[model samples]
Target chain A: MKRMKKALERVAETGFFLCAAAAVLALALIVVFLVAKGVPAASKIGLWPFISGTVWQPSAEKFGIAPMIAASLLSTLGAAVAGGLIGLACALLLAEVAPRALAGMMRPLIHLLAGIPSVVYGFFGLMAVVPLITQWFGGTGNSLLAVIVILSAMILPTMVSLAETALRAVPAAYREGSLALGATKMQTMLRVTLPAAKSGVLNAFVLSTGRAIGETMAVILVAGNRAALPSSILDPVRPLTANIALELSYASGLHEEALYLTGVVLLLFIVGINIASHLALRGGKGGR
Target chain B: MRKILDALGYILLWLCGALSIAFLAVILIYVLSRGIPGVNWQFLSTVYKPGLGLTGIRQIIWGTLGIAGLTLAIAVPVGVFAAIYMAEYAKRGRVLTAIRFCVESLAGIPSILYGLFGYTFFVMQCAFGFSLLSSALTLAIMVLPVIIRATEEALFTVPVSYREGSLALGAGKLTTLMRVVLPSAVPGILSAIILSMGRVMGETAAVYYTAGTMAKAPQTVFSSTRSLAVHLYLLVKEGLGAGEAFATATVLIVIIVGLNALASWIARRMSQRFTGGAKT
Candidate 1:
């Protein structure tokens, strides 16, 4: 009986170990497939023309994605800057100032914001944001401005949640000491606590930027998909993710490869930012 | 001077709070106003036509449920077992660190890339083609890490005392884990699985590649099917069905919010259960 029990225990333990390693297998598979499939296409396009050329007329056999690259960066930066401010303010309210009941009510609502599907956001942008932009700004409704607005809203929940966690992690002693020094409630929160949690705030910004840059569905709906570098916020522009999404279903041959290469570039950006944010978040925790 | 600055700061904070709430209100109000009128019984039960884009989304809704069901069924047992290993079975060492690293990077990988991978690996190489099974597999892989992380946390929340108490009563290790530990951890684990299902339901990009764009209910797991999110995307992009698009969006939002609330309530209950008697 004892031998049988030991054998059964060992087998179950081994099974769990194999189950735990499933993530390892999945990651390896993704890396292998992406590289084996993506690298050849990117190389065939010639690195310079692929990354630098502004024109993206796939039928003409010209596939420069620089304009799309520019649009992606521009909108991502816009979202980070705009969403960062609002998110930080909201985080401060939730973590530092709001009544417990209000904060409790709002926290899950914000989580639901994160839970809202990208397509729903896209629909909202098309019906609500686009028309508003056209009325106020006098250009096509689907433009960089619409993308920026939608992306900012999309990133806000992530930004607020991370910032709130960082703020909550700040030791009570720091706030107490600042108040002990006769600092006003607002002043202590703004100066002492904010400065202390700045690294975490920066982490929030990095992660939010990653979200904005990689965002595909909503940006596609609102950004006009014009394949041009926008001269202003109101001008239509196409980001890299949108280009891949819009054309991949029908695209074939070099056009197909070009879209896959576009995915490669996007994966690079996401991987880089994710690594940076992870490091920043870990470092912030250690420092705090 | 200090008083004026302080007052202004307070006002700014209050304004920020109101602004965040205002954003949610605008989205909900706009969607409900536009979409509620379009949700008649006929709009939901009939199949959509190619030329006539305003028919019911019943098939699309079924496809979404089917894909979500398959995803949860595959992902839960695997993820829960994996999480048990990480939290309870494995000793702390290099292998543990490697698994942790995998989860961290996997969390940040974007959905579009997952779409691309699904296309290459599932649709082409395996010859699964554009089918519900392929999409379900992709979604299962996409959400596996999330469920694993959540379940691992849940497993850790089970008190060591319970396990020891069962062991002290001469129960075997496996018996103690299955009978005593998992029961207490069920709420948290169940919540995590539900949340994963919600993610699979809302997923557009990952499934868009593998899930065929067939506009009707699938005949089988191999049959091509359309998801609600992709359907919503097509309706708006095609320029003819803006009204239908909003209605689909409303349904998607309602389901996603309902799932999120349910998962959160379960999570709250789990926490309360461990601390004291069930208060919620």
Candidate 2:
């Protein structure tokens, strides 16, 4: 009986170890695979021209991701700027001014908003937003401006939640101290609490930018996907994600690798953002 | 005067809140209006048709469930075990810190990147070839961080007394974890599963590469299939089927909202149970 029990214990322990090892191994495998495929593709293309060239014609064997990358940066920046300011203001309200009852009501609403699927957001953009843009700007329904508007709506919840958490984490004593020194509530928030929560606000920005950069479905629907450089926000444009998702089906050989390379560039950009935010937050902690 | 600025700030705050709320409402109303009115039994029951009778979302729904189930099966156990290892066994050293950093970084990587990796590794290199298994494995990796973080939080909240009591009873470390810790942390684990389900249902980018957008039921685990998400994407992208696409979106939205509500409820119940048990 003792020996049987011991054997059972051994099996359980081994099972536990296998499961834990598999979790880490899965992550490592993904990173290794992306780098392996992406590096070779990048080497063949020579990183600069591949990223900077304007035209992306797989049929003619000329591929350049510059325009897509530009649209991505432009729309992501637009969304962040629009969404971030509004989200920060809402967070301040929730943290400082709103009644307890109102705050409680708003909390779950925000969560639900956050929980709404990106596909639904995409459908909304396609059905309602794009038409509005076309009516106003007078071109194809799908434009970079449409992408910006929809993305701003999509990223609101993430920004609000992170910003609110950071605002709440600001020590009450700091606010009290500022008030005691004859500063107005607005002054205290802008000068004292905001600076103190700068890291958190920055973290929120990083998270929002990450979402904007990787946004696929909604942008794909609205970005008009015209492959050429977008002359204006009113014109149709293709971001990196839209390019890949729209073209992955018929892409053969080098065309396929080029798409994969676009994915690699996106991955590297996001990973860089993540690492920068981590270091920034860590530095903030060390300073205090 | 300060009074005027205070008033302006308050007004601005409410305006922001109202705008956010309006955006949410518009999305819900638009999707529901377009999707719900179109949903019929035939639509739900039939398989994919290009421009016709029933926009069979049934197969897509089933495929979504299967992939989600497979992901839960793979991710939940590994995540729970890793959480246990971190909370109960691992020391707070450089190795543990590195592990934590990796977990956070994993969570931060975009879904599209995961799709890329899935395409290269699972679909092509491993030669799973855009099957259900490949997509499920890809999703498992995607949701692992959520599960680990939730499980770790739950386990951390299980007070030191439980471990002491188990040790006093002469139970081994592993036994204590299995019998005492996990039962108490079951609610947290359930919430993690619920959250992951919500993600799997809504996800588009990651599964697209790993799971081919074929509108057919799988004959086996290795067979290719289209999930509801990919199904909706194809419908909209092709522009051949608007009515069907809206109906599919409505069904997907209902399921997603239901799952989100369920997760929130489960999380609340679990935390309540923990507090209630602790008081006793």
Candidate 3:
């Protein structure tokens, strides 16, 4: 009976181990497959002209991903900067100033915003924001500016939640010490609290950057699918995700592979950002 | 001077909150106004036609449900088990640390990259041939991190005393986890499902590659089908049909909102029940 019970226990333990191992293996397989498929494409294209050239013409067999890369970077940077500042301010407000009731109400609403579908945002941008832009700016409804606005709105919830969490993590003693030295609430928030929470705030920004750079549907609808660099914010421009989504269906042979190469570039960029943020947090912990 | 700064800070914070609320309101209003009037029983029941009147989104709806369900089925057990391993079984070691890093890294990778990976591997090599199964598998991969994190959190919240008591009564570890820990963690697991559902519903890029855009419902697991998100994208992009897209968008929004509310309510109810049980 004892031996039987021990055998049963071992079976359960092995089953649990296999379950965990399978999940990790699945993730590893994805990364390996992406690299294997993307590398040959990158090698054939010589990497430079494929990523740096501005024109993408499948008919002519010429493909350059420069515009998409630029648009992605520009819009992502815009959203991160704009959303990061607003998020930090909101976090400070929630942490320091708002009454408990108000904060409680605001917290879930913010989460709901985060939970809303990106496609819904696309619909909103198409009907309301696009018209507003076209009427005022005298350009096409779909442009880099439209992408920026929608992406910023999409990223706002993430920024707010992360910043709020970080701000709350700041020790109460720091605030009290600053107050004892005759610092006002606003002054303490700006000098002592903000400084203490800087790494966390920075982490939030990095996370938002990842969101913006990879955003697809919202940006795709607003970005106009043009393969040229934007002369102005209102000019139609394509990004990596949009290009892939638009062309993935019919793209054959080299063109399809090149598209995968674009994915590799994007994956590398995001992985680099993740690694950097992890290192920064680790360093911050060690320093403390 | 300090008074003015403090006032400004308060105003800015309120304004930010207002802006977030206003954005949600604007979206809901626009989607409903444009979409709701066009929604009819016929529109919800028929397959899409390119040139004819606005056909139903029934096929896409089914496709969406099929893919989302498959993703949930694939993701939930794996994620929960992995989380249990991480929280309860794994020792603090280099391997565990590496797994933690990988999980976080996976979470941060963009949906677009996932699409790229899916297309290259699943569509091209795995020869799944751009079917619902491929898309479902990709989505399962995409949501793994969210599920693992949520499950770990839920497991962590299970009181240590409960486990101790169960063990003292001679309940084996597996029995304790299956009978006690899992029931207590139901709400957390549900929240993860809700979150993953939202992601799957909204996803366009990832599905676009692995699941080719077919107007009809998939005939089988191997058949191609369009999800509501992919359908919406095609409608808007190709300028094929406007009213149907709006109607579909409205339905999508309603479903997403309903799921979100249900998730929150379940979480609250579960916690309340746990508290009530603890008191006894």
Cα deviation in Å at residue A5, candidate 2?
5.6
For B178-275, candidate 2 gives per-residue lDDT tens digits of 89988988888898889899999899988788888877777787988888888888788878578877888888888888888898898888777768
Error of 1 at B203 (Å): 1.4
TM-score of each model, in listed order: 0.97, 0.95, 0.94
RMSD of each: 1.8, 2.1, 2.3
Across B1-280, the per-residue lDDT of candidate 3 in tens digits comes to 7799788877887887778777767777878898999888888888777566547888889999988988899888888888888887778998678777777877887887788778777777889988988988888889999899888888888899889988999988887888988888889899889878978988888888888888778888888888888888778777766787898888887787788888788777766765775632
Tens-digit lDDT track of model 2 for A65-92: 9999998988999899998888888888
lDDT of each: 0.87, 0.84, 0.82
Interface RMSD over true interface Cα atoms for each candidate: 1.1, 1.7, 1.7
Candidates sorted by TM-score, best first: 1, 2, 3
Error of 3 at A282 (Å): 2.5
Give the TM-score of chain B in candidate 3.
Answer: 0.94
Model 2, residue pairs in steric clash: B46-B56
Q: Model 3: clashing residue pairs?
A: none
